[model samples]
Target: MILKTYRWSFVVTAVGLVLAAWYGLSAHLGIGQAIALVLILSILEISLSFDNAVVNATILERMSDFWRKIFLSVGIIVAVFGMRLIFPIVLVCVTAGLSPAEVIRLALAGGDPETPGTYGYELHEAHPTIAAFGGMFLLMLFLNFIFGEKEHHWIGPLERLLEKVGKLEYVQVIVAGAVLLIVAESFATEHGRTVLASGLAGIVTYLLVNGLGELFNVEEHLEHGEHHEEGAPARSNGPTPVARATGKAAFFLFLYLEVLDASFSFDGVIGAFAITSDPVIIAIGLGVGAMYIRSMTVHLVEEGTLAQYPYLENGALWAIGALAAILLISIEIEIPEVVTGLIGLAFIVASLISSIRYNRAHPEEAHAETAAAHS
Candidate 1:
């Protein structure tokens, strides 16, 4: 079953490694050096993006098979080529006042800071705005998740406190905005206005995507109506919106995932340049890593991993919150990639351990769940 789920990832890995090796030889960087760089970048991307896969699985479970396929297929193309490659070029072009052709030419020139037209340098220079936008968007995601109603709490005291605060409407927005203001004030000596505007845009983008999705979702619509079928016995107020939404609701969800992906990719895309300036190599390596992540998401959904390990989603969100903080803090102080990766991994690992203990202590619940699955 695992093999069937991840066959595509395996194929992409083989092809990407071959491409990495061949390009290293062609670029005269030596095959060994080329493979090493690609491998390092890929590992870094995967390490930094495990939380992304968890969050993605949660959303993907709410979508139908068709949208899920679209996400894995069309979405992957947009993620690998669009978000990682093309969008960076577009951003550089807009920032540098150059055309797409000129941007691509510079990218091919590689990553020298002294060079007039180094692609990596231009992209690296644009990091602050990228950080502000992506950071704010991801921060909102984490805020909304923790603030909204949840039956389980991963970090009892802190989560409970946040939940109490969440009872006030739009508290997530207020907190996120406050964080943005603080970040902007500290980085005021830098691109203050640009960062503020970019951060605001991120918040608005989230509101539109999330708001529109919820508005169109059948679950929400039914919940609002308080209607019941005439011939039916009494039922719960409404069904939970999971893996059953369709039509316009799913479309907004699709858009949300793409934006969410772009937010997650900001760090990886920038960090990849520190390893190698060759955009082609970065594309192949990160692209392959992305394939594996998509596969991992599907595996989690099909195996019902999130349902089994209930706190995992909360852990992933907390990791996202930490990353958001790091991204915002990075504007004033340079942060290491290792710090971000370690923080996220720690949350996920702790959550996994907690889940295991929870299951063991409640053997009856676990056995009942297992029996229901078999039935």
Candidate 2:
């Protein structure tokens, strides 16, 4: 059963290992060193992104099978190449006025000991802008979840209070905007305008992508309308409009997922510099990690983990909120990546324990929900 469920994961892992070995050998590093570094990088990426997997599974489970397939296949390509490799090069090219080829050369060259014009140096210089944009985007994601009403509450009093405040018009947006302004003003003195602009861009991006998804959500609209009529079931109406809208909705959802992955990648890319300034190594390591995360997401959906563990989503969202706050604060402070990873893992484990206890206490309720899902 395990092999059947994670067959793709196993395949990807095998491919990643072979690639990691080749890259390491080509870089002229010893085989042992290369393999060890790759292993470390992969482990770090997985630990840091475990919460990301949970959050992704929550979203992926809602998508149609076609979209899920795209996420597992095309999505991995985008995540590995776009975020892990090309993103830094683009940032350096745009910010440093270097050509793409030059950026790639500099990245492969690692960092210069004598001067500060290497790819790693320039990318580090752009950290403020990266942090502002990614921080604000993640903050909005966190705010929306916390502010929205949920039936199951992990942190009852706090979540309940936020839910009440959520009834206020655009509370999440207001809170996100206020926080952005405060962070920009207080900590972004050197690049105040740039930080503010980047943060605003993040907010705008989130609104546009999320709004498009909602607009294409024909199923949600049908379900809302069904509440007003007698004996109207909340399912797809038919084959035509449902199919068309599902395609559009899936496109928007794909966009949203990509943007979310980008936000998550910002920190990992920056932190990879701490491990090694070699862009190739960083890419190989993070790429391997990204594949695992994607596989984990699919596994979660296939196994109905979210449906079984109701509070897991809540835990993941809470972790996102914590991560967002940390990202904003990291502009002024030097928070260790391990701390970030630990906090997220802690929330996930706590939620899992809560879910297990709930299952034991209410076996009948658990069985009923499982049956409903299967039916």
TM-score, every prediction: 0.92, 0.91
Candidate 1, clashing residue pairs? 62-243
Give the alpha carbon lDDT tens digit for every residue of 109-206 in model 2: 89942358988889987888888888899888888888876757888899889888987999888999999889889987877887899899999998
Candidate 2: stretches off by over 4 Å: 112-115, 219-245
Writing each residue's lDDT as its tens digit, candidate 1 over 151-192 gives 568899998888778779889899999988988887645878
How high is the CA lDDT of each candidate model?
0.83, 0.81
The TM-score that candidate 1 achieves is 0.92
Over all chains combined, what TM-score does candidate 2 have? Answer: 0.91
Off by over 4 Å in 1: 113-117, 219-243, 369-375
